[model samples]
Target chain A: MAKNTSLYEKHLAAGGKMVDFAGWEMPIHYGSQLEEHHQVRRDAGIFDVSHMTIIDLSGREVRGFLQKLLANDVNRLKKKGKALYSCMLNEKAGVIDDLIIYYMHDDWYRMIVNAATRNKDLTWIEKQAQNFEINIDERPDLAMLAVQGPNAREKAHKALGNKILAAQDLTPFFAVDCGEIFVGRTGYTGEDGYEIVLPSQQVPQLWDDLLTAGIEPIGLGARDTLRLEAGMNLYGQDMDESTNPLESGLAWTIAWQPEDRDFIGRGVLQKLRDSGPNNKLVGLVLQERGVLRNHQKVIVDGVGEGEITSGSFSPTLKCAIALARVPAQTEDQCHVEIRGEKRSAKVVKPSFVRFGQSCID
Target chain B: MSNVPDNLKYTKTHEWIRQESDGTLTIGVTDHAQGLLGDMVFVEVPDVDANFNSGDDCAVVESVKAASDVYCPVSGEITETNEALADTPEMVNNDPFGDGWLFKLRPTDPNEISTLLDANGYQEIIAEDSH
Candidate 1:
């Protein structure tokens, strides 16, 4: 039996179809996934993402602890409430997990990690924290809801009332605490939104309030399509412990400046940066009729073979698109083998669609 | 909810077959199958002249979520294939019973059609699978 989230009953009440995902019973969709996808793009849509783990780190040595733990530099987070996206790497420079770290105060920070990698991430964090004076507190009593879209911030502000208006002016990748609610101007859908973290006891009421505010309740089905269209990397599929961030199209998240930040995987990352990675992640758009899917073979002329990690029909683009890891030398033109038949595809930089607009040429 | 046309016979695998007056058969996936597969991304149907035995894998329907094999409920020779699906696969997701008809076949033995389940029997199969 899979564990259910705090919103499971609320989801069922709203006619959600539950599916087992990462040892948790989650709502795949309420009714039409396409409608939900468009709703998040055009209007407001909310998702119950309490299944993800939230950890709060607080101590005088927290900055030092994070500088040594994460692949990216924590010193860059100078402004209070600012957030940084980084990857926790192993000794071999393989990506353990990618997470968002919020600098709440001088000595306190909050980290949100993927739900599936909760145990391993905690274990790794604990082993490293043993040498520092940091306190690792897992906030299991908190529930999270992500409301996203072009109108998401307005709708969220309406639901939160005047007290949360401070979050309205929050810059992107920043968080603000209003009373008991922590609202972050961040989301996975590549849209303007707020990811609200509040006590579990207040979640049911907040969900109802959001519904009353006309925010459509979305599910995991639409979430997958939206994230794929946004070109956001799913931790397990896009990069895992076996793959490095450089090959995963996440080199930007790595901070190599200041010359001597001795992060755990700095040596291997430096070596890989000097030599270059074998494969690179790119976005593929099918030129002809056909949908590129995961594990589908990609053939690039003069380069080598690669496979799509995430692919789907972009509702906004009205065509098939994909994220594939191919030979670093591969160029724009490629072919994807769909059902043993080669279909023409064009490779480009990612962020194919964002904020209800086309990001690709 | 879409109704299963009374004239067509369905299989446990959610395939509907229509028997023509001249003993020919036209096969397509059911609305239930398309609903389960979500968006149809690609499809692989057999060649027009290919012959298959009963219960053989003759076609494939790949969606963004999964890929499923469409089995032959009755042995037959493929007489015609829907070429339009190669360009617009969403036709299967939009109209699985009508425009999405996969292929036409001339049954090796016309009597094989009687072995397929009727609408009520196919409904029972869906009910059992849900549990």
Candidate 2:
């Protein structure tokens, strides 16, 4: 049997097509995925992200524990409610999971990891924390909602009522606490929005209030296209236990400034950083009428070969775009083998769209 | 429940066929198939005059998330395809029985029609499959 979120009944009432997602029965779409995708870019949309795993860590050595567990430095987050995105790596420099860490204080911090990788991520985090004086507790009682789009903030504020005032003026990458609710000014979609975490029991009311506010309910379908168009990497698809951050277009997330910070897999990453990653993740725009799909072969002429990690039709760009792992020397153009035919594609920066605008040139 | 027009015939693989006055069979994925596929982004229609054996892979339909192969329901030579789908593949979701027809083919074995499922039989197939 699949797990159900607090909004499962609401999803059924709203005509959502329920499907199994990471062991949870989630909505794939309400009526049409394309329309939902467009709605987020044009207006605002809400998604039930409660299935994502949230873990809380508190102790005298919380800061030190995170510094050693995550590849990104938490020392930069001096202010409370500041969030950092980092890839939790294994000893071989392979990515275990990519997640967001929200700083509440030196002793108390919250981390949200992917749903599919919950078991392993927890085991890994717990194993790393045994030596240090820390308490790692999973917050299964919490529910998370991501309200994203150009007008996402206003609509979310309207749905959330007075509690949103604390998050109203939040800058990007910052989070705020209003009693029992926590709002992070960050999202997977490249749109301005808030990822609100609250008590699971209180989510149904918020979900209904957001619907009454005219914010469309986005399903997992549109959630994927939106993220792909934004050039964001999906955990299992873009990178996994077999891949590392340097080759996954996540080199920017690594904080190597303080060489003394001996995080997990630091030595391997340091060697790769100096030698440079041989394969790079890049964006591909189909020069013809075709949909780019994952695992498709990509051939870089006279250079090398590669494969698409995440590919989809970008409703925002009105064309097919994909993120491909190709030989780092590839430039300007390549070809994707779709079916039995080789189609031309243009290579560009991994980010295809951002802030409701096409970032492609 | 999916709409299964009484006038058409369906295959076990979720394709609907309608025999035109010219004896050419028009084929497309069933309504339930399109609904399962969500929204369509692109369709690769088979070329005119292309010949295929029954159950042979002919064209492709891609939704935003994945691609599915469209199989030829019966052996025939392709007569026409829905060119409009090249620009607007959502026709598959909007009118899977009408404007969304994938291709038209002249049947080589007209007797094969008797082996195809009627609306009721096709409905049962979808129902049992879901169970």
Candidate 3:
């Protein structure tokens, strides 16, 4: 049986179509997914992201432990409630998971990881913490909700009341805590929003209150399209334990400053960085009528073969877009084998849309 | 509850057929199929005048989540396709029975239509599948 989020009953009552995702029974859509996508792009929408794992690290040596655990430099987060996006890699420099870490104090930090990689991430973190003096605590007692879009802050503030003011004043990539709830000015949809983590028992009431405040409940379907349009990578698809961040269009997330910091996978990543990656991830826009799909073979005329990692009809762009791993030298245009026919597609930067606007020319 | 019009015929794959007065038949995916597929983004209709065997996958309906094949219910020659759906595939979700009709076919055997599931039979199939 799939696990249920704290708001599962409320989702069913609201007519959400529930599907098994990452072992959790989560809503795929309340109704038309296209409309939900438009809602997040044009107005405001909320997503039940409680399935995402939240882990808090505390101890005198927490800061030092994180410095060696993440690919990004947590030392850059000097201010309290500042968040950093980083990829945790294995010894081979292959990405294990991408997560967001929020620094609350010198000895206290919070991390949110992908739902599908919960077990693997926790195990890895625990194993790495054995040598350190930090306490690894997975906080399943908390539930998360992401309110996103252009008017997201306004609506969330209306529902959450003055408690959200601290979050409202927060800059991008920053966070604030109000009592038991922690609100972060961050999201995966490339829209201005807040991700609030609260006590698990309060989720259903908050969900209902948000609905009363006119915030539409968006599901996983639109979430995928929105993230893809924003050029965000999905774990297990864009990259995994066997794929390094360099080839997955995530080289920017790696922090190389303080050269002698000696983080895990630093040696392998340094070597790969000097030589460069063989295959690169690029965006493809289908020039024809068909939809792009994962695993479709991409053929570059003189370069070589590549494969699509994530593909879908972008609701915001009204066109088929995809992320594909191709030869580092491939550029401009390529042919994608859809069904059995080779259809032409335009190659561009991996992002097609952002902040409700088309980013691709 | 699903919309199973008593006047139409249905296949297990969730397509409905209506025999026209001129021995031709109009076909479209059932409302249940469209609901299951969510919003349609692109639809590939069979070419006019193409011949197909019964149960052949002749067309495709794609939504944001997945792509599903639309099968021909009976052996027939395609006569017309709803070209408007190429630009406005959402018709399949908005009006699966009326403006969303996929294609018109001149049946090879009009009697074959009688062998399809009736409204009651189709509802039973949908109920069983849901379970």
TM-score of chain B of each: 0.96, 0.97, 0.98
lDDT of 1 by residue, A1-361 (tens): 8988889899999999889888999998887787899999999999999999999999989999999999889899989999999999999999999999999999889999999999999999999999899899999999999999999888878876875777978999999988799999999999999999999999999999999999999999889989999999999888999999999999999999878889989999899999999999999999986567788999997778999999887777877889999999998899999878899999989788888999878
In model 1, the clashing pairs are none
RMSD of 2: 1.2
Any runs in candidate 1 off by more than 4 Å, and if so which?
A: B1-6, B41-52, B79-96
Could you tell me which residue pairs clash in candidate 2?
none
CAPRI-style class, candidate 2: high
Where does the lowest 10-residue lDDT sum fall in candidate 2 chain B? B62-71
Q: Deviation in angstroms for A40 in model 2?
A: 0.8
- On the 0 to 100 scale, the lDDT of residue B4 in model 2 is 88
For candidate 2, the TM-score is 0.98
Please, what are the lDDT tens digits per residue for candidate 3 over residues B1-131? Answer: 66889999999999999989988999999999998898999999999999999999999999999999999999999999999999999999999999999999999998898889999999999999999
Error of 1 at A100 (Å): 0.5
lDDT of 1: 0.90
Candidate 1, residue A220: lDDT: 93
Each model's TM-score, in the order given? 0.94, 0.98, 0.98
Per residue, candidate 3 scores C-alpha lDDT tens digits across A1-361 of 8999999999999899999998999999998888999999999999999999999999989988998999999999989999999999999998989999999888889999999999999999999989899999999999999999999988888888876667768999999888778999999998999999999998899888888888899999999999999999999999998889889999898889998888889999899889988999999999998999999999999999999999999998899999999999998999999889999999999888889999998
